[model samples]
Target: MATVELRFSAQPEHVRTARLVAAAVARRAGVDEAVLDEVRLAVGEACSRAVGLHRSHGIDAPVHVVLTEEEKLFSIEVGDEVPGSGGGASAVPGVRASGADDGDDGAEDEMGLAVISGLVDDVEVTSGESGGVIRMSWPTTPATVLP
Candidate 1:
């Protein structure tokens, strides 16, 4: 497997840089053109979400992106530190709390999650020693085989 990692301040402008780097890595991994587009958009959305969370919480930390190319899959992980929380709080407006017990309502729209889910084959969200993580992966096609 080959991996590429990028780290930058959680600023709005930096989201575009993340997208570009993700696209370049996906392209180098032989991802399909259609899938490449999806990867770019997903990376942008993930980075944007992280940036918003950091800004809202007044946390000045870097957002980290890691792209890995394996024999059968291409994966991307976007992570950032969430302030005051153990990185488990939901930052996206419409996402349901990871493990909420509130009986009020589960009416959150989760459009961002929906979009990410639609684009990638698999997605996992978690809080870890590093921070909040959004990991997405797509299966590589036979055409994506390395020469």
Candidate 2:
């Protein structure tokens, strides 16, 4: 197994960098060529979600993106440092019951989650006081033996 870890300030612009890195790593890990765009989009959404949570909650902790490559799988984990972000409503961290506090609707968060679910076949979302993590994985093609 191999891993690549990245931490960046809670800034929206940095999400693009995370997505690019994820796609590059996924490609090298033998993820299907057609799935590269899905990986990029899912990573972008997850990173953006983390960045938004950090900003909204006044938490300066950097967003975390961990990419792991195993024999037949490639996984990426996006985490945020927002307290109580995962206690309830949705699987995603920022999600809340419709029309919750912060004077902001949770629709965007839900939409982001929906997009991620649509893109990734294997996904796990969890949160607690410590923070939250969205782990998404894709199957990797096995290396063919050349005679």
Candidate 3:
């Protein structure tokens, strides 16, 4: 397994950068086209959510993005500090993706958590002391293989 760590501002534009980073990891893992596309979308949504809800003593802090790849599986972890500094409410986590098993692409665009869950085979949403983390994973099956 290989890991790539990134620390960047939770800015709006950084969302795209985070997605690109995740996509590169997918490519390194040899993920298939379909799975890679899903991974890219899921990770992008996860990071964007983290950045959007980020709170840091009334100041926006950088979001930490961790990308991991093991064999045909890729995982993305997005974490950030709540702007309120660190409090119970600040600990309130944001949504992960759209929803699981909801193949409706439109739903994905509508729901944040649903989109991530729909794209990834596995997803874990956890809260941190200051912010939260979203972990998303998808199988990198080769396109040449049959489902």
Rank by lDDT, descending?
2, 1, 3
Angstrom error at residue 39, model 1: 0.3
- lDDT of all predictions, in order shown? 0.73, 0.83, 0.65
- TM for candidate 2 is 0.84
Model 3 TM: 0.70
Clashes by residue pair, model 2? none
lDDT top scorer: 2
What value of lDDT does candidate 2 attain over all alpha carbons? 0.83
Tens-digit lDDT track for model 3 on 1-147?
Answer: 338998887676878888888888777666776676777778787776665555223445678888887767777787756533122222335422223355453233236666776767688776656666777776666545548
* Model 3 spans with C-alpha error above 4 angstroms: 55-57, 83-110, 141-147
Candidate 1, lDDT over the whole model: 0.73
Ranking according to TM-score, highest score first: 2, 1, 3
lDDT comparing candidate 3 with the true structure:
0.65
